[model samples]
Target: MADIVVRRVDLGYFVRPASETGTEHARVEPTLGYLIEHPIGLVLVDTGMGRHPEVDAHYRPRRIPLTAALRTAGAKLDDIEYVVNCHLHFDHCGGNPELAGRPVFTQRSELSLARTTEHTIPELIDHPGARYEELDGEAEILPGVVIVPTPGHTAGHQSVVVTRRDGTIVVAGQSHDNASLFTGDVLSQRAGVGHHPVWIDRLLAFDPRQVVFAHDNAVWTPGTSQVSAS
Candidate 1:
């Protein structure tokens, strides 16, 4: 099998407070997406943010439309054969509507919540010709590339695992806000000190060489215990 190539797509940046309290001040964070060049076809993870009045008022995301973002990654909207959303959050699945008939994989639970709850903008989802392939659990949507449920930030959140000759790379979308938090969770699990999700164990089993984040540009290298661009 050919090696799967994973490229980061820079969607744009947004400013938000580090903590809920205004005392912490605001921090600038980048919204990221991933483009996977697979032998089967091109697969996209997350579609960047969508535009809405309420959404804008809240996040105030400086937008980079999916088309522009994809282009930066040497891909195009038409080139994407399938999409796997980490979750149905507005920032994660905003471009889902533009995908139309393309297969967009998401956990059934996540889809149900997105459709019913006030968590995300309704117009961003259930758009014209929206086709959702809801999964009950982990699924190998593409050969050597699988979607594993890693619920932490959200009940039905998922992450993409791409197996390469070097090692596995996990595209953890908002799994723990940042790679450091994920590292802490992993360390806690190792020590058996506190609660950690079952999915963390599953991810550790893969022995990932590098773990990437959606909002963070840093790559978590477990062996070195350091973050790098990689």
Candidate 2:
């Protein structure tokens, strides 16, 4: 079997506030994910920014070009076989139309909250692909890929564990949007204390070769893997 490989595709879209980085835009291009060589074929972690810039520009979504992001990775929407949402935030699921009829795996609780969170932006939840198979509970999506429940950022928020031929890596969607958070920054779970200490413990217990986060500009390469970034 060709070992599973992971890539962090910077689908340059939104950024943090200027106060955070001091640059004119002071933003970051959030990354989408690619989990390769899994038994169920290929899986795209999140669909980057969707097509709603005009609708929510006045509010607060600083988006980049998603089409260009995918192009950099040498991928088209059709290349993704299955889609897994860390959570259904607008920026994350925007690219789901790449496979309108395909199944997107999500948590029922997260979907419910996404639908009725009241305070969340409505545009994020109004996707045409919400008919996803709501995760009943923790289980495997592929022989080597398992979805681990890591609540706190949002109910039913989960991460994927890709067990490759060499070592395992955990795609912690929002668990650690950046390395600083996982390394102990109080602001780690910025989406509202949605992170639990237990989840990190469990994830590390598995001893991942690397930790990939959804919105960060960096990656943590474990001392163990030659193939992963340190």
Candidate 3:
């Protein structure tokens, strides 16, 4: 048996749709890429991005500081075999075209919604060379790595749970960008923030030793303290 290692890649920021005007406002979003090294093969959590004509022409995905970050993690576009995006938003799945023709796993619902909804990257789900999966339940993406459905950010959003030897680590993706969301916010709850109670409860129930976000450098580990990328 071989061990799989999950590496978080800081892919930098992009503007998000503003909360009020529905206008695109730059928010220094924390883009992330996860690398899973397994004996079976190299599985990449998210492709991050280089550039895209469709996105550039339409949504205007901002500059990426990820080339250095991806190299630092020893990952090249060609090195990736499998891709699992927590969800398919323009910023998160912008890199999907780079890994075209590869096996990309995403929530089944995300794939379907990408068709009519503006919330996703169209190329991601309908790429000519890509193999997409709209998974409904848990599966060991790699040996010790499992993908969990923590839908909230969108109906199909999910988090990746890695059962490591030291302890379990949950890659909470967009379910909650920071530790603050977990504590419960009345305003956000009323406005329908992130994952619902069930999804949030499920991640907490696992009691993962560490929780990491796809965007920023924030980290939450159980029985410990809070940490962020400063």
Predicted model with the maximum TM-score: 1
- The digit string of per-residue lDDT tens for model 2 on 109-222 reads 988888787534465465565448779767788788888888877878899888876788888888756765565532332234655466666676677767778876566664
**Model 1 lDDT on a 0 to 1 scale:** 0.88
Best-to-worst TM-score order = 1, 3, 2
Compared with the true structure, model 1 gives a TM-score of 0.95
In model 2, pairs of residues that clash are 13-64, 15-28, 50-94, 152-194, 153-194, 221-230
TM-scores of all models? 0.95, 0.77, 0.80
Tens-place lDDT per residue, model 3, 1-230, is: 75667788767665544652245654556677777776777777766654557556543455554456667888776777788888877666767777788888887887787777965656656777778866987777776778888777788887888776777778778777666554343234445765456655566666677777776676775443445443
Model 1 residue pairs with clashes: none
RMSD of each: 1.5, 5.3, 4.4
State the lDDT at 150 in candidate 1.
91
Give one digit per residue, the lDDT tens place, for model 1 in 119-201: 88888789998898999999999889989999877888999999998989999988867788788878888889987777899
Q: Kindly report the root-mean-square deviation of model 1 from the true structure over all alpha carbons.
A: 1.5
How high is the CA lDDT of each candidate model?
A: 0.88, 0.67, 0.69
lDDT of 3: 0.69
Pairs clashing in candidate 3? 30-215, 101-129, 108-134, 152-195, 217-229
Query: Per model, how many backbone clashes are there?
Result: 0, 6, 5
